[model samples]
Target: MMNALAKQSTVLDLIDEYDRKAAGVEDAIKAYDDACTAIEMAGTIMGTYVNPVLRGKAYVHAREMQKNLLSSGWKAIYSRLNIDMIASARDKKLFERTLADPPPLTFENAKATFGPYLENPRSHILRGLAETFAALDPAYKSHSKVKIGVKGLPKRVILSSFGDYSGTYGRDKLRDIVNALASYRGQPLMEHVEFNAISVAHRRGDDAILDGRVYVAPERYGKADEYQTLDRGLTIRLFGNGNAHVFFAPETLKDINRALAEFYGEVLPDAEEEGAKPRTGTAVSKDLQFYWSPQDVIDRALEFAGIIDLKEWRNNSPEPSRILEPSCGDGRIMDGIRARGHRAFGIEYHAGRAAEARAKGHSVLKANFLDCPAKPEYDLVVMNPPFYGRHYVKHIRHALQFLKPGGTLVSILPATAHYDHGELKGEWRDLPVGSFAEAGTNVPTGLLKIRTPSPSTQRATSW
Candidate 1:
């Protein structure tokens, strides 16, 4: 009887220890919840500041907090917790459905959308900030240091420097980024002030170092670099080492962040979906009407025509040939032909494009080549015709009529045209893929060369 009583007592002691550990775990969880609440409250307060200096300081602090949280492996922890919660739910299917159909504008959704931007240093948002800073500060040169001053803002903020060569940002490359940022204006995004700076750097052994530290004058903040005053009430200054100082109202910062999140998460996806739908009739006609050939493609087509020897054309030895371009939008091919010392003429269907070509000093007629009578007047014919619905076949056949008996015809046609139109005799060379991507199209193209039958061959065939 004593052994049984001792065993019961031992079991009770073990239960008591387990209860104590459970209580400790609950307390830890409560403390964690409290800390998160405090952080959220802090963020809310920081975002409400109106003073530029205070807002800037708050922005810096928030960024530091974000860096710390991300570095502490919170992402992995959150991911694991998310999975465990869904897996352990009373109804797993319902939990998954709820996650999939989250409230569109809720804080949780916004956080999920913008979380990757905060974590990635080279994200589009950060790069946009860098470019805006570079555009505002004229004194900001790549791999240099310069003082930046805001007219209304009094505080001088020093940005952290980058340590390596790969960290540098060039001013020339910021043009496209600046243009993209400008395009965001009036779209629920905040726009603002202008600031400029200039500085030089010297190479020290294998490292590039700024000549002097950035200095802001106490009175009037020094002379302004040639900059137009903007009314947006925000200023950004950049260093060549990719550090940037941004000054704006805290509310504006929130608005910009929210706008960007919406733009990336919703607007862009909708646009892509709209573009994915197949086009019919006029839509297809407008989209496929023109895809200008790149200069390299033009040179290759000229080489295939056997008019001017590409190697000795520059030496003024090879005789220049007369060339005609049909459907020459803006006369780019004509310019190439002229550059190679060839006599070039063009026929354009678009009035505005013909005027543009004429303005460039090229002889272009505002008429369709198909309507014009082919006189077999040209020594060589080079054209990049419309590639829609095998339209290139009609254009190629008509262009051949303009070629002399011994003259060659070179046309930039779709690669599939070579296989589809086996009736047309020619030497087809496939152009590199994505050759027209810079011109806003990705249609695979090939250069087709065909020579007219000379008098001797015609007579022999007639016999």
Candidate 2:
């Protein structure tokens, strides 16, 4: 009888496994059908029934704005914004699917949504902050920094940075950090720490010499290259023989000790204890929020322009070339261009983000793209241009002016603008991309590949 019972258990386990696999297949099929059908329908109604291109662009940009609002304030703003977008779309099929696959959320399992801004150095400087979070908050885990909106208040920043490259480079790379007084936003995270100038040694013709190799990264967002404005330039440099040299700031020692203390207080509270509490979006909690990651727009641009094949790029576009993005947000598209080992430049409208972009080792400016003068020469144009603008007519016309004859204009625009707007007349090959509504978390649901013809071939189509 016992052997018979064991055999019964094995059979039941197999049955469960088979059931899961079957469900997975079903979801995949449903998503594929939904996306493909939606794309076909969008093409048919470019000017009439459904302008998915417009709706898709609206969703992506709105999500970016939502992220900004939440960071300026708390969770409710981010939560309500995304939920409202879903509601507004009223995609009956999408709503039903979401209900079927309700997110497994929990405060204990939640993580902040950092998006693609991870390529920046400020992203790295937040390591110490996360260490502190583990020490101070029991429910928090390793997650991206996010902003949330609070009621009766404008907005507020919560969460901390996700480890990026800032920490590796020292003070210059880190943009946001608390100052030496253990202060943040001109307030104190602590009273103080003892400061003393100690001898940092290095070999000098076999004799050790003293050098000041000390610095402190902020506990939060603080600009380093722009430190003069804050009057917080604390790092010092020491030069040596044989052209040998080093740079250091003193606050780093104190910062290390603080992190060590926090680490002990928090991360070690329940050490050596691990159990499966449902890992992948499986927890049920109130605080877990939706996360959005941006696309590799720059890389997509290369493929869209037919500059190189999709699988292998650097080898194909290795020739010294110029690349540009008009509305680059946090270097997502710009970084892609840089990866191809080409000279790249981008224009962004937000001041703080422009600075943030520069801090991430990018050549960026805080200026409206439309106001900027065109360079009149670039090999390729890769942009997911802003959809909400009438003045964009001039912006696109100017951007196109910069491109050399035969240069590619790989962009994402609302299909409605492709029809209704009084701009963008050219011999264009539209590569119709379907919505990843059910697949891509936060993304351009659809894409149009635009090509600008030579002056002689251009026709002025009245809109």
Question: Candidate 1 lDDT (Cα, whole model)?
Answer: 0.52
lDDT of 2 by residue, 1-463 (tens): 4555544323234334434544465455556667766776667844365444434432224334333332322233224333221211122224445443333222222222212122432212233343332332222221111112111110111222212221322221122222322221232221122011211211112211123233233334554211111223233222331222222233433343333222222110101112223223211111112111144433454666655433365454456567677766577666666655555677777666567668778888777787788776887777655433344455567788678765777665433344334266654432222121122211112234455566656544322
Let me know the TM-score candidate 2 reaches against the reference structure. Answer: 0.34
Candidate 1, residues 300-406, lDDT tens digits: the string is: 88778775644454554766777899888898988888776677899998788899999999998888778889889888999988765456777889999998888
lDDT of each: 0.52, 0.39
TM-score per candidate, chains pooled: 0.39, 0.34
Range of the 10 consecutive residues with the lowest summed lDDT in candidate 2: 264-273
How many clashing pairs does model 1 include?
Answer: 9
Off by over 4 Å in 2: 1-293, 296-299, 309-318, 389-391, 419-422, 427-463
